[model samples]
Target: MIGPQPVAVASAPLARRNPVAKLAAALLFSVVLIATLDPVAPAIAIAVELAVLPLFGVRYRVLARRAWPLLVSAVGIVVTLVLFAAERSGRVLVEAGPVAVTSGVLLTALGLVLRMIAVALPGVIVFATTDATDLADALIQNARAPARFAIGALAAFRLVPLLGQEWQAISMARRARGVDAGRNPVAKLRLFVSTAFALLVGAIRRGTRLAVAMDARGFDAGVPRTTARRQRFTAADALLVAGAVALGGAALTASILLGTFRPLIG
Candidate 1:
């Protein structure tokens, strides 16, 4: 007979810290960055975030890998803004038919790019460090989220990696059967769409099955559910929340004092 099982514990500080605390920190930082889209504010915030990432076990390379998509999108925005943003009375840098690049426009676009990076990177770091189960638990326990909804979200998060593996398996099977088209962009696009459709169908099937299983398990039986691991808010969590508030406030105050407080919409 199975007697007593030892409790599993997190060794790392990031892993041990409550997910609600991390979520609060990310939201606070994002709000500050979104309110003032000035380059100086984001620049300072970015520096602080960069230094803070190591506390969450995030390396520079890992951060870059996770944020490359945002970086690429930011670059695209810069290019589009430089080409099409309404020209203001400033020194014109480039004048080509229907496109005018000015110093003021470039600066504006740069500020947007910097702000995007500063706001998104912290969230990415938090997500990368936190486990999906821990996050769902924290949300349910600390944030007072509905248990059913939180569990459903946790199930969806679990399916993501499974879906990736399914896609890779399908691709490999196609290659084995010699139907995989390589090097042709049009064929690749079609293949990607077909794979995506397969994944969608699989996801729907899995979700339906999961819902039915939950119902069968009496999850909808109007009885309060008990958690396997009780989520607790520690002193560390309180400190994290306080630190988030202080950081966001400091960033905003510094931006205003430095005269770079440019509200995104005003």
Candidate 2:
């Protein structure tokens, strides 16, 4: 789920540039996109990020695999807002118990879903392109983030693929054990939850063993470590930083000039 295969990024001629540079550029651009609530800012960010996705050899098909979850989340948010928080409905569409679906509430919630996709799409692009190990290094070394926190985040990310595999294996094993088929949706959910809890227990045990093994191997606590692959900042780094800053400045100026700089939270 994270970090590029070192072999993959390393082999690409474009990957020779510093990892921290890419991370900085992505983070700065993302921050600018997030800073302004205006949909235009995120739309611009999505365009820029999508343009850069090819440079990293990202597959949209593979990216869609991750994007669906985000899309589902956006949909869930809209439904929840419509059900519970749509207190002011200019036009009522449905009435169930205390819940009323109104035209205005539906429109506002739909706008939020659109906003979520605009915001999330660019982040998905950046994450797909970024190498997790490089990200850890960029945060821990270049950005001077707390090494423990960075390392912990990096470590957690390592389990993405393993979890997926384990899920498949668990499903097969359950079937082999003569688990009933064609269960109701609730029953299927329960079965999955039970299997997932078992997987979590096994994963925790594995993590504990790994921690002990690393400690036994004389892994130092709170020590600054040297990188096997050092990322040296280059001219590209300067240009990217300047570009992100310019975009952020322009977005701010637009908001102020139009007198429509609404905070994203509201």
Candidate 3:
């Protein structure tokens, strides 16, 4: 099942490559972007991140649909920070007891919100194009990471969508069975909590079944994997990682030159 609707970008050959490489690149680039709070670095990172939506066959509209909340929350964070951050020595914009806004504080708040957006935007980009199963295989096989953990993670990933559908189905079934799950405010809240608990129980049962199945197959932590599909880092993989590095480097350079690297405190 599709998580969200796939975007309309011309599907690139990038997804065929090893997912570990792309994941590594994403993690590395995000770490680099987050290591500093300089607005210049994150701003540049944001631009690069914008390019990802299209490149990953993700439509702009799809991104907007999903990312609008993050954008809103980022704005909310800035507003809250600006209001609540302790008054500082800089030229005051507004002054209230214990809560002060200054030009410097406003700049800092803007930088903070921008940085949060920049840091979070990339995972949405990469995961949009990336296949979860493929990524897990790459982690286990190509990276020689622990197979058990990778497999468990992959199981959880698959379960997310399945469980959601199951929850919806269960809710409909419950309603059809005269559960009195009317749309009244109190009833809706009760339905939500009850449905959530039911879903949890169902999930636990499914997890038990999955564990039994895995055990029957000798899917132990130390077991050597049997080859099914081969996973390797291709040339595209190198390009992805290299491109992330270049983008990160550019961000760092801009931050230093623009003197936007403001650390939180010594």
Top model number, lDDT? 1
**What lDDT does candidate 3 reach at residue 257?**
84
* TM-score, cand. 1 vs. native: 0.83
Off by over 4 Å in 2: 1-17, 33-38, 89-99, 136-141, 144-155, 221-224, 248-260
Q: In model 3, where do residues sit more than 4 Å from their true spots?
A: 1-10, 87-89, 94-99, 162-209
Tens digit of lDDT per residue, candidate 3, span 236-265?
888889988888888878888887776544
lDDT (tens digit, per residue) of candidate 2 on 1-266 = 45334322344434444566655655666565555555555545555555655555666676677689877887898789887783665987888888888877776665566556655665565566557787787776677777666666677677667877888999899889987446588888889789889899988987787667656754536566666656556787667667756765675566557764546666
Give me the displacement of residue 76 in model 3, in angstroms: 3.6
Off by over 4 Å in 1: 1-15, 87-89, 170-198
- Note the Cα lDDT for every prediction shown: 0.80, 0.66, 0.75
Model 3 scores a C-alpha lDDT of: 0.75
- Candidate 3 local lDDT, residue 256: 83
- The candidates, ranked best first by lDDT, are 1, 3, 2
Clashing pairs in 1: none
Worst 10 residues of 1 by lDDT: 1-10
